[model samples]
Target: MTSYVPEYLKAKNRKTVFDLFLRDPELSRAEIVQRTRMSFPTASKAVDFLISRGIVTEIGSEEPVGRPGRRRRSLRFNPSAYAALALNFEGRVLEVGLVDLAGQLLQYEQHAFDCFHQTENYAQLAPMLQAVVEKSPCHVLGVGIGMPADIDNNAETVALYYDRQEVVVPLKDLFGDLLQALQLQAFYGNDVNLACLGEASLRGGAGEKMNLCYLTLGTGFGAGIMNNGAIWLGGHGRAGEIGNTHLGAFDLKGPLQTQIEPLETRINLQALEKAFGINLLDDTVLPQDTQDQMVEFLLPALVTAVYNFSFLFDMDQFVMSGAIPNRLPGLAACTEREVNRLLAYRKRSVTISRPVSAHCTLIGAANAVFEGTILSELQG
Candidate 1:
């Protein structure tokens, strides 16, 4: 006969066991009990519950170290039990990926758009998303959309595209019917914010507790802020708009005609390319003089942003990513030197590094779905 367990206790035990499997990949019932310090009966019940829910699976067994008479059955977190569809909208390209619960990308495809003539063609997203969901290897949990737009997370609406062209898109309204048809929930977030989450996922425990900022230097500039493993969306979910922060005045024509420019105008890929007259996308190495000039123009603004972010959040690290920073070698080291120089008063220097993976935004979108749906389901 099976003993009854309270629903709350069961949920808590399930989370504990699930977290262990996530960290260790595989564990036996004995190991789960030993690591989580739960009674054997409780651990068995939790594992049984997880197996029933298809979250954990019993695979082949391992023999005990001393007895070596019988094998102990191993339980593994079944990453293939569920999948998520991730979409990243980067100016003219829409990248779609099907990712497993383990944050592994199973399939990917890119769709291009003519921004000038085909701005309204974003409606194609539904069929594309539906096709990917149908092709998922497991039960599709939900969809996560990351775009370069000011998102009102509460309403799931795109307040503005910042590119100065696309219309105000109510993303939930555009995708609501599709979500209903597929019977899956939808999540919306800024592309950079999702990228930060992706980067954080790569770090695991180190990232979980650290205050991190993911700054992207591309056609435009933006940042994703993470506070103690959670994405820190401000009062309106617009907290990481570092690109819009105004720097001091500059003499555009002369001292008489000074002008104020945001960080984007002076430090982004477009500005760097225009300043150096070199096409970064062409994959040619920047001339030393060009690199020096680009660094000179960017270092000050970057230092200022880092300085402000450091004081505001007591940030532990800054991750530099996106097109310009990724392509430009030595950018992170250069920026780090500049920031360290400016922050001489601090006892310890801030850590700055590049992303581990190029497809960070796509991975982050999938991660959002996993955390929101799977983790919530486990806890709920």
Candidate 2:
């Protein structure tokens, strides 16, 4: 049964119609009315408002109607309605991209980093970013930056615990000048979480009716949970901090450090070098063939975390994303096998699977811009 939708929600419905048009430029008025579940008059009113505001346009007519009274007109969102900037502010580099509401990357620029975390670090990043955005062809809606820490979106600030470490200084203030200099509104979020959102929205999971958990395994690890249809950012925006949670203690100086240490410290490219005298980066090696060792080492510790998360969140599907190659295949299969092994010996059965890709966080961050832009219209 459909519940009553409030007037405010109806206004939101209008934006949803715009989003549908943006996602599918060939949608008809009748299709919008049917998909959005609003009255034909209400849907037409929304379309009229959008067209009047220059946010929507009648692209062309649909195919000849076989059994209809009249042909329907196809509607599309104005690609030039607004623009957005997306950045993946990783510890090693800054990836900047200019995109429209349709998630098209019209332009992009990448900047290498000499420093990992410093107060004055982003100063250099500002000019490089401003240069790219300044050349964009659309009215820039805002800039979304992906970082490695938890953010308080409401206060527009990074949280307390994240600012304590010298390696990861206060980031909110540093990003302010870059955003202000470009005259763009800036939003910050955890990189892994952003990547998950991107993957869920842009790729294979778009229309899937299921819960998704994107786990990024790279220099660090984090989980992005999408339940129902929206990203599940916990009450304080820290629900996805699975990497920080301690699974257990390992000897720092022991040879087993590479095996029992945390997944981030164990599976990363650098950690592999410190453990097994080989550099995947320098060797120009494919992660698939070389990452099995790291995965074999870190699988147990990760399983504990995954099982605990399942117990806490009751989620069944898991995705292993982020940049490690051979790591995911063995890691995912091992994690699933272990979980199932443990579960089989216990009470109930469970099903688990690996992520679609390692770059889910990066893609998820991109989708964040798409999701935010379309949803912002509803807020207005």
Candidate 3:
């Protein structure tokens, strides 16, 4: 059975319409009505609302055919209407970008912080956001943030978070303040999930109704699960903290290690250095294939991790993406091989998938802003 779009999503169709205008700025009402398959009254109401919000405008007009020529106006998204801020805090720096409703990047900034511990991240971030907000165009909507953390909107904490040094930060608190201070709404999401959201929007995955799990491998590992086009934020808004699961346990030195070894301990950058018996960061003698070997070991483990998660969660398929652009294809291939290997053991088959295009959590962070900004305009 084909599930109908939910009422909330139907109400949010203004976003879908505006997104179309952003794509093709000269679409006629008849074209939009045909594309959206919406009743004329519904389409007119939504389009008029967008026009009133200054998000859409009548670009020009087309003459009606035959007897009495009537000018029918064509609609276009006003490129100058509003803007959004997108930031991704992963790896080397805190990346910031200014994007318009049409997804055009206006400005971008990055501040590299050698130390990203929880104690000082907000101290570092608040000013950066202030600077971006001040420097950005006045029409900017709000900010959207992507972080390597498990965000609990209700509790306002980072349940499981990572920084450059595998440190923790109060993501929700810092985000809440930046949002309030800048007087902008914000969303704090796991980086992997944001990448998934972005891929679902800009990439070929758009308009498809399917369950998706976005797996990210970089300095850290995480997954974003979307079921039937809706984010399944668990009770604590940490549904996809798959990196915390243990692939295998070994007795290491300490109380926390004794508790249980996390998969992060087995596959993160720190683990790769330990596994290779060399310093990948500082050592120049590291072979060219050093990164490849790390992927060979970790990709299989990650594949099993996904298999485990899928079995438990009943997800149909997944995609792998993140900062490691050069490595995604290999990771996808390895994951496919590993999944096939597992199928032999289970005596059953399952589907595995990849994103339609190269992905950046930064891009998705931008989309989060666009989606939210549209929703806000609709409400107001």
Predicted model with the maximum TM-score: 1
How many Å off is the CA of 249 in candidate 3?
Answer: 11
Instruction: In model 1, state the lDDT of residue 82.
Output: 83
In candidate 1, stretches whose alpha carbon ends up further than 4 angstroms from where it belongs are: 1-22, 28-49, 60-73, 114-119, 161-169, 177-183, 205-210, 249-260, 378-380
lDDT tens readout by residue for model 1, 285-361: 77777777777878887888888888888885899987787666678888888778777776657778988788888
Best by lDDT: 1
After the best TM-score superposition of candidate 1, give how far the Cα of residue 45 lies from its true spot, in angstroms: 6.9
The sequence of per-residue lDDT tens digits that candidate 3 reaches over residues 192-284 is 778777766654223435467887765667788877666667887778878778776555665664677667666566666677765444535
Show the lowest summed lDDT stretch of 10 residues, model 3: 160-169
The all-Cα superposition gives candidate 2 an RMSD in Å to the true structure of 5.5
Q: Cα RMSD to native, each candidate?
A: 5.7, 5.5, 5.5
Q: What would the TM-score be for candidate 2 when compared with the true structure? A: 0.76
What value of lDDT does candidate 3 attain over all alpha carbons?
0.67
Global lDDT for candidate 2? 0.65
TM-score of 1: 0.81
Q: What are the lDDT scores of the predictions, listed in order?
A: 0.76, 0.65, 0.67
